[model samples]
Target: MSRLAIAAAAGLAALALGTAGASAQTVVSKIKDRGYVVCSGSQGVPGLSRPDEQGVWRGFDTDICRAFAVAILGDREKIRFVPLNAAQRLPAVQTGEIDFLSRTSTITYSRDTAVRFVAITLYDNDGLLVRKASNITDKKQLDGLTVCLQGGGSLTEKAVLETEEEFGIEMKKVYFDATIQARDAYFAGRCDSYVTDGTAAAGQRATVAKNPAEHDIIVIGKGTEPNGVAIAYGDDQLFNVVRWTFNALLWAESKGITQANIDEKLASGDAEISRVLGQEAGFGKAIGLDDKWAYNVIKQVGNYAEIWDRNLGANSPLKVPRGMNALYRDGGVNFPFPWD
Candidate 1:
């Protein structure tokens, strides 16, 4: 063959390969073209994903979604929050109804294999909520008792059932649509126990009953689950975007970086923080985002600790301690993957 013909054939092959690479990297490009990120959250859990009196979605889960928007889209407001129930969360992500689900979903082997968990933002555990007057302190005392549960294939129910068998007890299940309903039934003595996550149990108990202190909704038994956010499986581009976005938040918190300190730190050129925030090194570019992706997230949404403190800390009505949610430095299991 002529040399010119050979060179032309090689150029065509290179062009075909470039097209394939572009198609493989379509997730980020598609999201940017859409102009917004659709995020799934819960309807109304006071400190988790409820709308305030001003009609704005605010909570730990909501903050995570907004952070993703800031990272990928560079605008915290460039997100649409779709409130989904426990059952709807997985299907929505799988069907592409939303880009991601930041609802308080527990990551499990079944869920991780079925749906995709981008990152574990929060570590949660199951606990029992009972009226102080009921005097049910331990799981052993609940044999043959009625328990209020949110019963539409809830993992919380499964966790309770597993615990019941482990403790050699039997409890009746009374189904309720929402935690509020179940809490009311428990407080009114309609059921003997309320089974849910420790944070959720505390949030529900504090909402009703004049003084939460008057009701002894203790966290009985060890936590049976780990909660986190969900993304669609098999989308490597989107998964990395979501995963590293979460890691950036946790890393910032671990390094004692806050929204207030982000600007000064970026200007000061701290090597570690700058690299993570994409100020000194273009880490976001490696992850299919602009260099300022992490900076935008920290500036707009704050870090993981800030979100936890604002929604579930001592100042908030939930008043739950960090416990296992604290950073590794503070004796908790929240360790961040190295940005490098």
Candidate 2:
């Protein structure tokens, strides 16, 4: 063929490839077609995503996935949890193996640039779990110690490195593919310290430690990381569904709406509550969901506070305080957008 004809043929092939790629990127449509949203969770993080004795996944992170299912499929139970570790979480979402990642991963600059993080579901800081016999009261004490952490360059590793640099100290790092592996190695004395999110450290100690009282979870740094669900880049519709589902949880908490009170709140005279509960017409249609989307989430999954209290709060084994995860009304950072 002539050079000009060859160039034209290459352009047509490029157009076809672009069209095929775009068609393959359908996140929400695929979930709708499959009738369930597949969410990525940790292999096991007790208060975050571990299965109970009944083999049922239960945790704050688990509820986040359930909330997504309720928002999209109008049924909280319409979800399948794919167990992943820090190393496997992002790729699972990127490759469309999971709808969104909620395995206690945090938002970093690189991740934010590569994918879309919908909302900050939990506000946490890097923490270290050390044997109580060590009597290490401060995070800096962990400096120069070998630490066990999830490998494949997880944010926990990044946090540890950053903390070491900021404190003018050094640490020996041991890597594992999964959180369970890291915790096992820590318990087995592979490392002097185990580093991860504050709540996760607590959960690990609570669930996996031979004696929970034998270890202490300590904050290692000044900065708090906002953990959120991440999706493939540039799909605004699916992103909105995930983002607003989180907001709905926060908003419900702000309004004192709970699984028990959602029905009563639907009849509330407050205009904002009414609009968010789907008594007003624009919410569901605007988000490409049914009018009862938020209602279903609240009814089936409960609000953010309920999920927290149920999984990580005083009622749960973790017994973690709300801290920064609380709604703004309660002086926490979780302030959702106004529903107008």
Candidate 3:
């Protein structure tokens, strides 16, 4: 065959392979057919992902799952949260056991290779929680103190070590198989402090402590933890849907759009607002859903601020400060990707 003919044949072959690659990622379609999304969670971590008294999951992580459900199915009530331990979190996503993970997992180099991180939903820090009587406000106070932490080379272990190194101090670490064991031991005075991610520490103090007022969350390393939404790799379509749903939440917050004001915003004449609200944009169609996907998220599950306040801030038992989790405009770290 002539040179041009050979080139044309090669192009056709490439197109065929690309088409097959695209067709293989059907997570979105499967979710649509199933009527809901399956999100992975811990057994119960107050202010994060934990079942309430009525057996319904409620927390920041669970609310993130709800946002995904709203964006994809347009139903705030349609979602299933399955409890998975630390060992099971990543594998479940890789094996299709869970549709995604919102268990306040920090984005790490090794984890990024195994699954696609949809977005940084929370900016957390590893911390040391001590009794109010201890008055351990400075890292200098941590030197030589025994800390109760989860063992097995987990992030908690790493956080404790990082604190020791950063503060120019050395700590005695007592590691346990499960966080509860470590926390229970800490409450029992087995150690001087409890080491874990800041949020988990806050949760433990709020829900497990005999007197929540006796404990305090002393943030460890500078906000090094970028907790993310994790989904399986090899499925860009599914990844984009989850990612943009998170973005929609942040974007809504950036524009001061709340659950109570979304309908009014939707009726506004602003073009970008209209597009983001799905009144004039094809965002949903571009991601293989109703144009009202973002609209549904804000309207039903609420914007990021609403979820945070209700789950981790003013409205919840934890009442943790927004800190790094707040929107950038509000003097925090969160910001939305451009909708256009």
Candidate 4:
């Protein structure tokens, strides 16, 4: 072959290889081009996802999505928050309407088959929200009660069934299209109690009730419900980004890294911190992101513990106890997956 022809063939081969590599990360490439991430959340469930006085989405779930935003784009505010009902979440993820579903979604066999679960970010159980006037202080007192529930494939709906079977009682289920609707029903004296995830139950009692002291949230099952962040099935490359970003929050908290102290930690000589913070090249290049991906997440959005405190603990009105949501070493279920 002529020298010129040989050179042209080599150049074409290199271009083909580059295109193939980029195409492997379809969801990531698409989001990068669009310049923002579509993150799924709940509709006006305080302590999970709800608008503040300024209409900005703020809560633990909002922060979970925000962590991914900063990890991928280095901008936590570059998020298009799509509030999803129970039925809408899975389809939105499967059809590419959102990057990942970060609502308090339980990981069941059916759901895991439909979409890839990034990680169980919240550990909770079903709970009943009751008015103190009703004098029903225990789950055993819930017999034959008319309960407000968000049915139609929601994990909250599953709570109804589980509660009935476990307590040996029947509940008259009054269903709603969304969580806020059900909470409203209970507040209007339509149902005896409102049933949902324990975290959201506390949110309703704290925020939606006429007086926070007038209501109580009673956790239903003794077993834990693992609520995961889900993405479309079969997108392994995108999965890696979302999964590690979720883990990075947990990892940051485990290592005593906080938004306030991250800068100091970054300057430390610790080898693991350096690698995780992307002071070295491997973590970022492997995920097709900037070297400071984990740093961006912790610095911009704060770690998992910080998010919980701001949204559900002392900083927020809810002040919900961290039961199963605490770290594994702290007598709860969450364990941070190692960065190595």
Give TM per candidate. 0.88, 0.88, 0.91, 0.91
Worst 10 residues of 4 by lDDT: 215-224
Compute the lDDT of residue 322 as modeled in candidate 3.
93
Best by TM-score: 3
Q: TM-score of model 3 relative to the true fold? A: 0.91
- In lDDT terms, how accurate is model 1? 0.80
Error of 2 at 165 (Å): 3.5
Answer with 1 or 4, whichever has the higher lDDT.
4
Candidate 1 residues 46-163, lDDT tens each? Answer: 6778778888888788888889889888998898888887777889988889888888788877788878887887777777876667687676887888899887877778777777
Q: How many clashes show up per model?
A: 1, 0, 0, 0
- Per-residue lDDT over 209-322 for candidate 4, one digit per residue giving the tens place of the 0 to 100 score: 879898877777556788888999766668888889988988898999999999899888899998899889667987788989999999999988899999998888888777
**Which regions of candidate 3 deviate over 4 angstroms?**
1-21
Output the worst ten-in-a-row residue range by lDDT, candidate 3: 19-28
- Please say which candidate is ahead in lDDT: 1 or 2: 2
**What is the C-alpha lDDT profile of model 2 across 1-340, one tens digit per residue?**
9999999999999998985676455677688899998988788888998788998888998999998898888887788989886667777878889888887878989888777788888999888888999888766777778898877777677788888878788889888877678888999998998988899888888888989999988777668888988998878778889888898888888888999988787786888787778877766976678888998899998888889988898888888998887776777877988665
Candidate 1: pairs in clash: 132-216
